[model samples]
Target: MAVNTVGYTSQITAGFRAVELAHNKKPIIVDHLAQHLAGAALHTALADYQQLQQAQGPGRSLRVPARNRIMDDFVLEALQLLQQQQQQQLDGDGVVQVVHIGCGMDTKPWRLQPLLHVHWFEIDQPAVMQLKQQLLQQAGAATATAPEPGGADLGSTTAGSSTASLAQTAAASDGRSCVAPAAADHEQQQHQQGVRFPLLPQRYSAVPADLAMVPLAACLQAAGFQQQRPTVWVAEALLYYLPLDVACELLRSMRALSGAGSCLAATCIDAELQQAHLRLPSQHYFSTNKVAWHFSMDELAAAIGAAGWRMQGQPQTAAQLARERYGRETYVALYGGAECCFTAVPG
Candidate 1:
């Protein structure tokens, strides 16, 4: 079946752009798996990406480096905090769940070491999900017999170390603490349901759903998501594409599905940036990507707060944070405070 990427082509391009930025050795934000995942669909945005890469020169895109730093830092920080919470819960049933809403070609399950123990649910359009599964299977097949790329054996056990070790520790503490058996069984069931990827970590599952059409909470429950556990909802570069009401509804649904201590980490293009794009000549690749920016920083934070999450850190411009985190030497032009990333927890 031909893949339909209608309103989602920008996601593909963003992944490819990140891959190119990584290739240029500009402060790596994405990992090898993410780069590979992005490359899998390079054909979709090859012309535009290549044109931009060549026109701007390698590692010199106007906004990519800053954007990557901001987005990656927010996700990594949130996952680190979530990992700490998961570690504390390890003495109990300690299984943290992560739901990546609109996870198009996302490679976090493999890239983020902490996520190895996470029950990762990647939700996206049916076609995007299917395509990602296909790509993962091919990649998995190629790497099956080889040791995992980053020198960590998938089966290794070390005390309080990696996810594999954490699982071992949990299983040793109590047989019921391990989520693998049930997750493996569920993985098999998902395979039968046509939402499975053979190469993905057993803890990872993909759910095919159009957030614009289906209720997010229902789809998540059908995928075996549990509300009682500590969940981290990631909506990177996702909410802005949605209409204001739909985006707000998604936040509300997430709030309803979350338990106490649940967290949300998200990135968005604010209204000011959207307006700037409109005022400028349509020359940049971003303008042609068809993304809709509907919220100002205050508006986004207010909506999220209304949905029952307490903002964690002060909202900062992507460029400012990127410069602070990575140093000014790697600085690129800021998108005029038009983009921001932040994290929040249940109020």
Candidate 2:
């Protein structure tokens, strides 16, 4: 069966929006690498974003800004919670493994590599994966050819230059030496053409799979994911695109695959928002035929608990988090009833 590209394309758009926000310096939530990975495709979305910004004036928009910020906050908080757990019980090798589901143009592995000894795996559609690999390869080439900072017009350099600079900066921040140029290039080449790219030094892996058709657990195991190791599973803004039963089944499978000390972090659409969107005369972000289901905070918690996991901390609402972080009255009016974020651990 042919997989619908709607959900996958939306994920890419979200990534593009994140890159836009990062460039504007409103809040440094997403990695700058997202901009590079998105390539020229981001220009259209960004142009729309700029128009929206202008229409709303200064710091307001038709819920776009609030939504983007909220999503970014959710991801940041989830990763932070995952890091806290890893810090408390790092393995003998001092490495943490994370699996990002439906990861479309996300730069978490690249951005977080320098901070921790992490083995990161990103699972997504084959098309998205292919495009990502190409962008990364182009980025590597650009980084290799670009002149060193202070010697040329840095603004004209490619995304590779930015990536290399980020890696070096991350290394410096952690009191470590930068990655060797030759090794970096080799690793990039190895992953560019294959399904499994063993990103050296950082240990990043990009696995192509469609969760609806294949067994996720089996795919991860084949990709070198260890069932006995403590793992962090991230499903950011992905569940709503799946049928309710399918989403629950995925959670159960994840629970079985996870060891005693593993954790899962995810985001879900609020029940009210889901219903409201369903009733709308026309859909904006998702096609009615594509979005199978959406879960409320309570529904999500129940699903997680049923899968043998314990919920940690209160469910974080996007609206509340935005209001707290941005302190704008408009947040209450725009995002007061949007989505939410949460974390869970094996019971």
* TM-score of predicted structure 1: 0.71
For all candidates in order, the CA lDDT equals 0.58, 0.56
Lowest summed lDDT window (length 10), candidate 2: 153-162
TM-score of each: 0.71, 0.68
For 35-87, candidate 2 gives per-residue lDDT tens digits of: 55655546655655566466555453224335444554544554555556657
State the local distance difference test value for candidate 1: 0.58
Assess the local accuracy of residue 178 in candidate 2 as a C-alpha lDDT between 0 and 100.
22
Give the distance in Å from residue 267's predicted Cα in candidate 1 to where it truly belongs: 1.0
Best by lDDT: 1
In model 2, what is the error at residue 84, expressed in angstroms?
7.5
lDDT (Cα, tens digit) per residue for candidate 1, span 167-244: 343344322222444435534544564543333333544677776676777666655566787788898777876776
Clashing pairs in 1: none
Instruction: Judging by TM-score against the true structure, name the best candidate.
Output: 1
